[model samples]
Target: MLVFGHCFTKGNYTIDAALKGLCTEEEEELERTMMAYWANFARTGSPNGAGLTEWPRYGAEEEYMGLGVKRQMANG
Candidate 1:
């Protein structure tokens, strides 16, 4: 249930932890989605991609992606 530092950890940790049942299915899904976003952003300038949730640019709305068991867009 600890999401802190997950993005900085190795990808194998996510897969291994999921395979070992150390993480919930929801957590795994969120990690995978995050990984995809990161990879896409590294390849391109933006994180937006097909099949993934839209990551809106930061603006006056102060919107941001709320990463958790249930990932969603949240307004600050």
Candidate 2:
């Protein structure tokens, strides 16, 4: 299982900010995307779904899916 810090960021980029309802549209979308990714992974073995970017498999490249204000792939 992979662990990430997607849902841990929000308006204030804090845990409390994530739980509150004062998040911006980007923050809200980030939360939604993260949830969908996790839900898809729960239903299937992979996090890739109909509209999401293909989550790359972890390997020597050491890449990861970034769930920040803007969604993108990043190298770890």
Candidate 3:
């Protein structure tokens, strides 16, 4: 399953500011990106969305997107 946990996203602390902290442009952009991903995933089976990085296929690499203040891809 996709891990949107504290270790993945900005962290649990940000939850407290979820209602008020999206004031910055970057924060708003990230939120919009996340919402789009979720919406597309709900409509289709894939989480792909416009302007989002290509989600790598599950394989031996074990790669995933570590979404946070700095969104990036990681392998474990």
Candidate 4:
């Protein structure tokens, strides 16, 4: 299974730290993108911001951001 969440891992002396060095450049980029989204959401009510992929609001199309090897907007 293609599991995620490694990039979002936190804490100083935890499994996340131990596996921190194992992240590839792509994974690191993913982390930056996700962090940007979170920070933007915290600063504003929406996650959409400049220089990032446009995240559509949840609607009938069921669109969402797909965080993975390559981050992009996806729709169900």
Candidate 5:
């Protein structure tokens, strides 16, 4: 199922709340986009299979994509 969560981020980035001083228009956009993609995946079990950019599945790699337009890790 397609889903988005604070997950390891905990209550910092939830569906109804975001980190204090961090919740802004930019965050709203991200949440909206996540919701859209999440719904699509939930319904189809595939995200952007065609006519869309391929979103890679997560791996054990320490680095992952982030807000800075580059891959970064939690400690970065």
Candidate 6:
């Protein structure tokens, strides 16, 4: 279902005034999964699945996805 990347991200990008670009493949995979989930949400108001939590629109005080800053890194 529609899930927020925060549900899978458990690391901080910075600590102690230090800017450490900590990125992991596992995190990237999680991000991808979350993005796909959102695609389903966009097409339909609800995500199709069993036992999945209901996804609500942001600003609605309900159990749903929450968004944080999304940034991209360049390797080329």
Model 2 TM-score is 0.68
Question: How many Å off is the CA of 63 in candidate 6?
Answer: 11
Question: lDDT of each model, Cα atoms only?
Answer: 0.74, 0.71, 0.65, 0.76, 0.47, 0.45
Consecutive 10-residue window with the lowest summed lDDT within model 3: 1-10
Total backbone collisions for each predicted model? 0, 0, 0, 0, 0, 0
**lDDT tens digits, residues 1-76, model 4?**
2125575565644777567667777877877777788999999989989998888889998988887777777788
lDDT of 1: 0.74
What is the TM-score of each predicted model, taking all chains together? 0.70, 0.68, 0.64, 0.71, 0.40, 0.34
* Candidate 2 C-alpha lDDT tens digits along 1-76: 1123444553445565445555566766776778888999899988989888789898999998877877788897
Query: Candidate 4's C-alpha lDDT?
Result: 0.76
Q: Give one digit per residue, the lDDT tens place, for model 6 in 1-76.
A: 2233543434553341232234355555556655766676688755533433344444534344442233322221
Error of 3 at 2 (Å): 19
lDDT of 5 at 39: 71
Q: Highest lDDT among the candidates is held by which one? A: 4
Evaluated against the true structure, the overall lDDT of model 5 is 0.47
- lDDT for model 3 comes to 0.65
* Global local distance difference test of model 6: 0.45
Q: For all the candidates, what are their Cα RMSDs to the real structure?
A: 4.7, 6.9, 7.5, 3.4, 8.8, 13.3
lDDT sort, best first: 4, 1, 2, 3, 5, 6
Stretch of 10 with least lDDT, candidate 6: 67-76
lDDT of 1 by residue, 1-76 (tens): 4463354455657544544535666776777888888989999978989888889899999999987777689898
Query: What is the lDDT, from 0 to 100, of the residue 58 in candidate 1?
Result: 93
Can you write out model 5's per-residue Cα lDDT over 1-76, one digit (the tens) per residue?
1133332244545543444344555455555556555777898885444433455555665444353212234422
